[model samples]
Target: MEIYALYGPSGTGKSTSALALAHKYNINAIIDDGLLIYQGKKVAGQSAKYEKTTVQAVKRAIFFWEEHADAVKEAINHYPIERLLVLGTSRKMIHRIQGALALPEIHHYINIEEIRSSAEIKAALFDRGTQGRHVIPIPRIQVEQDFIHRLIAKVDKIFSPKKEEIGETTIVHPQFQTGKIHVSELAMKKIAIQSCEHLPFIESFRKVKVDITNTPVVEVDASFIIHLGQNVNDLANTIQQHIYDAFLEFMDLEVEQIRIVVSHIQIESPAHA
Candidate 1:
């Protein structure tokens, strides 16, 4: 079990690089905040795209993170500190945790500060909505040499998952491949809600409040797709069309990319699925 910690200033591509490492190393389990995780070969993580920059949105994002504590803890325990390839920043936080946990094999906390260039460190204002700064550096924290050694041991575990989960092509995580894949033009919270209105899936849906123009990115829970339609394929197709048009109508451009997160799937119900 090997734990490689990747963290740097925001937008430094820590998560992105971690994903790439996972794919390359053939490792499993990536734990992070604001990620729409799923059980599949590949998962698309998402955050709702917003047109208006507001303080409320920032609070909500933070609140949502607090809510996932149990889920994250479970994932860490199941895999142990050894197997986790963490996208983290709080060294003091991680250190305190390390002191508490009595796992001898858990070694390795590879800080990604080595990758962040000085150019990236320079601060610049970004159009990121309610969030503080789009990309801010997390100050480096010094840890004791003894702790570093212990962490290193845990990280060097037997690479589990027999057979080649990722063959000759080793790119463990998509996030590592690039920065967040956001359809900025389509920033909507509700999938079926937005789909029903612009795309014409359901008859009754409230209007989406966020601005779609200028910013064209959107967010969706890939798993939580519409199922209560007459036909699933028809719903899927209609949903795709709606997402496309919304991008054009709001953002006033052709949709270059559509990042889907298959996080939620509508199950069959007594009324309809």
Candidate 2:
């Protein structure tokens, strides 16, 4: 089925526009994460953010989407009685999604203008707008500045926020674990999962859980294995790389020694992620 993706920074009204269009088109339902109801059935949303509640929301939307996809294609002669639409971030992402679904091009709805103004950002944050879904930090794009600057502008509202409170700051307990410490395997595992927020492939990161009872070492279930757009080998390497990157962030330790524990690949995004 073709997706008229509504991609924009935090509160670009993607969901609203999707619904309005759906109504105007007389199509069955809205296909993103919210306002999902068509013909008394629900639709599915994206699943990159794997929180239980959020996943349930996406799955709910997906069911409705899958159920209505074909009907949508057949019922609405013009889909809009005027036009059809597809939405998402860069044309690159939208195009990728189009090919994946064998969908025709969207009528085209690109709105980076919302991202250019911080005023818009604030409104989106409070209004519960579409919110960024590309889900990658600025520096993470691995692209040249001009392009990176533009992309970052579009998705800056979503990032791994720094931890801070009041004027008082607490220490991060142990800096390093060399000889032996009370760091439980479960603790380390928990740390890894928590840190996944700091990198890309947030969805894929869910598959592997960590265990530490194995002594100064740790057991990891790293299986990031889907390179949407990147060097296949490089993509594999990145999954491990970003995990370790997140692992270190979670460690929050100022240790001199380093231990790299890699298990397997789970899910993979493109190189830019």
Residue 206 miss distance in model 1 (angstroms): 53
- In the order shown, what is each candidate's alpha-carbon RMSD? 18.6, 21.4
* Per-residue lDDT of model 1, residues 1-273, tens digit only: 565555554434454345445665545655443232222121322221121333433322232344444444444565423355545445553443333332233355556656533322221112222222231011012112111222211111112245443311111211112233344423444542454455433433323333333233443433333434456555555556677665445434344334444444545554553
lDDT of 2: 0.37
How far off is residue 91 in model 2, in Å? 2.7
> Candidate 2, after superposition: displacement of residue 36 in Å?
8.1
In candidate 1, which residue ranges exceed 4 Å CA deviation? 34-67, 76-82, 93-106, 116-273
TM-score of each predicted structure versus truth:
0.32, 0.29
Q: lDDT (0-100) at residue 257 of candidate 1?
A: 36
Model 2: per-residue Cα lDDT over 1-273, one tens digit each = 343555664334343344334444445534333223333232222222222344453343333355434444344333333333444435555554445434565764546454233333333332232213222111222212212212222312221124321111111111111122344546666665564444443334434444321111233344444455544456445445544565446543221222333345444455533
Reference-based TM-score, model 1: 0.32
